[model samples]
Target: MTLPPELSPEHWITHVFSAKAARQGGVIRRNLRDIERYVGRSAFEDELKRRGYHAVENAGQLIIFCNQEPIRLIL
Candidate 1:
């Protein structure tokens, strides 16, 4: 289901992060610009920390890992 566009950035992100897909250890990708524009960098980072999740930025996208697991670089 798609969320209405009228929701605030924080609300939107919260819903996405709490969705079934996310809860099942799925990864969610979002546009970096949209996040920075609506939530601000610091606020976004704080939310991630509060949720005990991990995120990475790549190619102008923010990739969020829903579970609280140590992230390792394989490259």
Candidate 2:
């Protein structure tokens, strides 16, 4: 289900990065521009660090891995 467009990035991220979601090996994909505009790059990185999660960007899409495991990119 799509979230309401009016939802703030902070609230959206909070929901996507929940402990339950993380435990289930959840992955979230978001628009890079929206994230950078609403959350700021530094704050987003800090949040990832605090949660021990990881993320990567490609083609204007930000993909977050809600786990602390090492990520390998297979091309």
Candidate 3:
């Protein structure tokens, strides 16, 4: 799934749930511009953790893990 251009960090939680339920592995692309609007990257990451996602960000991309399985995510 592509990240919504204007997604707020709170709304991002929904996407995480959906992706996890779908078991859709492989790159889920996101826009860095969208991410930059988050109040704080650490807070956003904390929220992700609350919803059972583990992510690593690199050069405007994210590698996500759900249930300990890698999900190729780009942000």
Candidate 4:
């Protein structure tokens, strides 16, 4: 589908798209993120610690303490 020309990444997240192509009734997210922050292949370090997700960065992509093990990864 063609989005508005002015549409941005943040705008896309704010778009309340129906989960027609996904599972169950649907899922909606009150996105509290700024897309610009995650662009350019940046690593997701802080989230790893906050969310308990695994960190598997190849190199210097990320640097954080997960549970206690030093990890590096790009979300």
Strongest candidate by lDDT: 1
lDDT of 3 by residue, 1-75 (tens): 566557766677566446644365433444454555643566656765775666666678765555555556455
Candidate 3 residue spans exceeding 4 A from truth: 1-7, 20-29, 69-75
lDDT of 1: 0.83
Error of 4 at 66 (Å): 13
List where candidate 1 sits over 4 angstroms from the true fold.
1-6
lDDT tens string, model 2, 1-75? 666778886886686666565668888777877777667778888888998988999999988898888999999
What is candidate 1's lDDT per residue for 1-75, written digit by digit as tens?
655657798787777677777979988888888777667778888988998999999999989998899999889
The most accurate candidate by TM-score is 1
lDDT of candidate 4 over 1-75, digit per residue (tens): 545656654455334223342123222222123223432223223433454534333333332222443444446
- Give TM per candidate: 0.79, 0.72, 0.48, 0.24
Give the deviation of candidate 2 from the true structure as CA RMSD.
2.7
Error of 1 at 30 (Å): 0.8
User: What C-alpha lDDT do the candidate models reach, one value each?
Assistant: 0.83, 0.80, 0.58, 0.35
* Clash count, predicted structure 3: 2
